[model samples]
Structures are given as structure tokens and as C-alpha cells.
Target: MAEPAPRGITSADLEAVPAPLVAEILDGVLETHPRPRHAMAAGELAGELIPPFAPPFARGRGGPGGWVFMIEPELHFGPQVVVPDLAGWRRGRLPAEPATPFVETPPDWACAILSPSKARLDRGPKRRIYAEAGVAHLWLLDPADGELEAFALTEGRWLLVGTVRRGEMVALAPYDAVPFPLDALFPLDAPAAPTET
Candidate 1:
């Protein structure tokens, strides 16, 4: 009989492997994995089904001047090969597209959703990696807390632009024209009522 799969893979193991090998592995895993959160967010934003605003593009856009892509990037940060939840890059700064889905180039903006499985990675090391990459914008969304934190790159460092909490309204940087209601991001449930004894 075949040996059972290992319980977990160490960062050392990941570091020892080549980047191309890592990309190949991630491509296979991502292809078979059904990312419901990504799909739900993308779908809700499509076809005017959700609120009205500029249409969101995925995997970046390419044009004469430059291109921007919303990519699920794989990064070799220290000993770990991190696949950020979402990333975007301008054409001028990106590497030539590879045949595989994962992009080696860092993005201009990176967003990570808080998940129980990788919460620390997203909030800690990943934040530092994006800052080091000089990403202009970083959005850390905590679905559990129903909060959105925005960070901007300033002099090669990250500055907290703002934090929007549930029921608060705030405009995001790079897209200041867009106004988002904080509560809209959370589950669609009726607001709690005041109780009087």
C-alpha cells in the first residue's frame, strides 16, 4: 500500500525546493481547490449584482502604458512559500507572465483575508513581505472582526492610512472616490434592536 501523506510540511522543506517547483505545486493545488471566498467576492462584485462602483479587474490589466493584475501570488519569504490571498501589480513592475497561474512578481497591492488556518502568517510575516516589496497599498480584512485596515507605503515604510470598523464609513486610498459602508462587508443580517426593561 502507498504511504500516507505527511501531516505537515516544514518551512525548511519549502525553502530547500526551487521556486519553480513551488509554483508548480501551488498551481496544481490551487487548480483543484475551490476557493469559495474568492468566488463569492468576485461574483458579488460582478454584473451589478452588488453596489455600484468601478468594475473590479482580476489578475491585473495590460495596456500600452502598463498593466495591472489581481493575482494569487506565491512568495518565498524566509523559509515559507506564501500564497497571499490576493495581489495586484502594475505591468511595468511585473515579471513576464509564466505558463503557470502563480506569478513570481510582487504586486502593487496585496490583500489578505483572515483565516483561522493562516491568520498569523497573514497578519505578521506577510505584512512585512509586502512592505519590503514596496507595495503601495495593503488591505488586511478580518472577516471575523468585520473590520478593514488600510496601509500605505511611505518612504519605503508602511503607514496606517485608516481602519474601518463595522457600521463605520470610510474611503479607501488609491480609490478614494469609492465610498464603502463598513457594515456592508459583514453578513447580511438585521441590526439588533434596543431592549428596554
Candidate 2:
């Protein structure tokens, strides 16, 4: 039988690892999961999706804005330190930035870009942790399937708000302030050449 997974990942477990590696301290065990082929591309794609909204909610320059969204923010909840693909906070709740490198307060919203290698952890343990941390909204993006699923926490349980498939434009909370085009999140290989008649 395979050895049982560690009870939880600790910060020390990740100390020796190189900076290039992506790792998270889930529950209490150190998880160094494999990186998927599209993980970097998916992360970059996520970075692109936010600029359009930055002027409005993120920086609070205009619009019905009251949010601060960040990419790959290091979050600390109790003894656990987890990093989500994207994390957002209501400006009112976090008037000032934390002095520490990692914020202890849980984010109001978080988005996780799914990859084959990290899907299980993101959907399972990571989801549970986010719920426990009192995240109000959650979004999961699957690049391979070109899908985005949004959920809201109801009494600490996740209730599906909606799902956006490739080629579909959707406005899902809490970012529903603006509609997002699924295709824009994942770019296509290239334009097909016209066939000669």
C-alpha cells in the first residue's frame, strides 16, 4: 500500500525547495505537486483578465469599485500558508495593506486556475481550506476544458452560482460587475487559413 499523505504541509518543508518551484502548505502538510504543461500559460492568461477591471475595482479609480485584486498572493491563515492563482478583497474590509509579506485575513474572493496536475488538490483540499477560511466567493478556471465555475459560500458550504464554457461570455460574482469572455481567458493556437474554393 502507498504511504499515507502527510497530515499537513509546513513552511519548513518548503524551505529547502528552490524558488522556481510552486508549493503550498495545505492543511499541515507540504505539497509539492507536479506542474501541468499549461499551468504557466493559464497563470499568464489570468493576469490579462484583470487589467480591464483594475482601473475600476482594483485601484478604486472609478466605477462601482471597492475591491483589490491580486495575483498569486501569499496568504497565511493560522499555521497554513496557501497561495491562490488570484485573490481579491473588499477595500472597506482591508483599508490598508498588511505590513507582513503574507496577509492573515482570508480574501473575500479567490480564483484558482486548474491544471491536470493540480486539479485534485485545488478542487478537494484547497476548496475545503478556502471554505474554512470564510471566503465568500470562489472561481475555478479549467484551461483544458475552457470552463469557469463560480460559487458562493452559503453557511460555509459552496453553492454553484454559474459556469461559463469556452466561447461564452459570462458575468459571475463577485467580479460580475463586468462580463468575462471565456475564450479570452484561454487563447487559441492560431487563426486557420481560408480554404480555396
Candidate 3:
């Protein structure tokens, strides 16, 4: 006889998780992990993008100001509930205030600040889910490695568009309106990564 199928999971299961721990459902399973000690890149990334791309008062700032950003917004794409480190929506797509605390409409861009425990899940299941939901862009910012990887959804898959390491300035697609330095997102005093032969 075939083995018994596991029961389906839901958002309520995530709500039941205790405080200080983050919960997410992946591939029909509810998983929880302790939050990262520091999300420096996530914080710094918001600093860089919001001033230029985000709205309400960005119009006169000299940067293209037609996007709206949120930090750690709970996004529901079908039964999957994902909270990206940072997410953005073009103003035209989200012209008005959202009706609920969580958003069901997919974002134009989503960036994940990868922690040790969540890296595998973000790069695997979560990435797949984003592609399946037709998210236009995805970025992975690894603070430990001081690197940022940008991907575009092309032909129903993620195609890596660019990678910028510490101290480099980049102007990448979808958000190529303004160039920013990668150094701004990583700490100046962090130890250098090991070099490969």
C-alpha cells in the first residue's frame, strides 16, 4: 500500500508560532526558524532604495519616484505566505492603500536577506514560489559574503542578471534608474571573505 499523505498546512499555523520566531509555509509544510541576529543589509538596502524609488514625497528628490516599498510585508500568493526582507510595487499597480494587513497581489520586486537557516529555503522553495506567481524580479543580498545577486523572471524561470560584491557601484535592470554602491549595504568593518585559488 502507498504511504499516507501529510496533512495540508495553512496561514493559521504560522500565526500560532511563538513570538520572535518567523514562520513560513513551503511546499505544503509549515516551518519556523529563529530570526537572524541582525539584518544590516536589509535595513541598509531599504535606506538606499526608498529615498529614490518610493513615493509619498520622493517626486522632487530627483530620482524616479514611481514605486512603493515595504519592509517584511506578509505576502499571500495562494496558500503560500511569504514575508520578503524587502518588497516593492509599481505605483500604478498599487495605486491605493491595501485593504488588509497582508497583500495577495504579487509585488514587482522582492529581495531576500539570506540568513544561515533561511538561505536554503529562500533559494529553493521560496524562489520557486515567486517564479510560479510571476514576480518580475528577485534579489538575494548576503551580508556575510557582502554580495548582491539580481535575477529576472524570464521564460518562466529566474535568469541571473547581475552580481555585485562589496565596494562596487551597480546600475541594474528594472531599477536601473539610479546607480548605487554595494558598499552602502554591507558594513565597512566586516572581515573580508576568503579568496578562492
Which is the leading candidate under TM-score? 3
User: Native-vs-model 3 lDDT?
Assistant: 0.81
Pairs of residues at least 3 apart in sequence or in different chains that clash in candidate 2: 8-28, 8-29, 9-28, 9-29, 9-30
Local distance difference test, each candidate: 0.53, 0.72, 0.81
Off by over 4 Å in 3: 1-10, 188-197
Between candidates 2 and 3, the lDDT winner:
3
The 10-residue segment of model 2 with minimum total lDDT is: 188-197
C-alpha TM-score for every candidate: 0.59, 0.80, 0.88
Please identify model 1 stretches exceeding 4 Å from their true place. Answer: 1-67, 75-80, 91-97, 191-197
Worst 10 residues of 1 by lDDT: 23-32
Descending-lDDT candidate ranking: 3, 2, 1
Maximum-lDDT candidate = 3
**lDDT, model 1, position 40:** 38
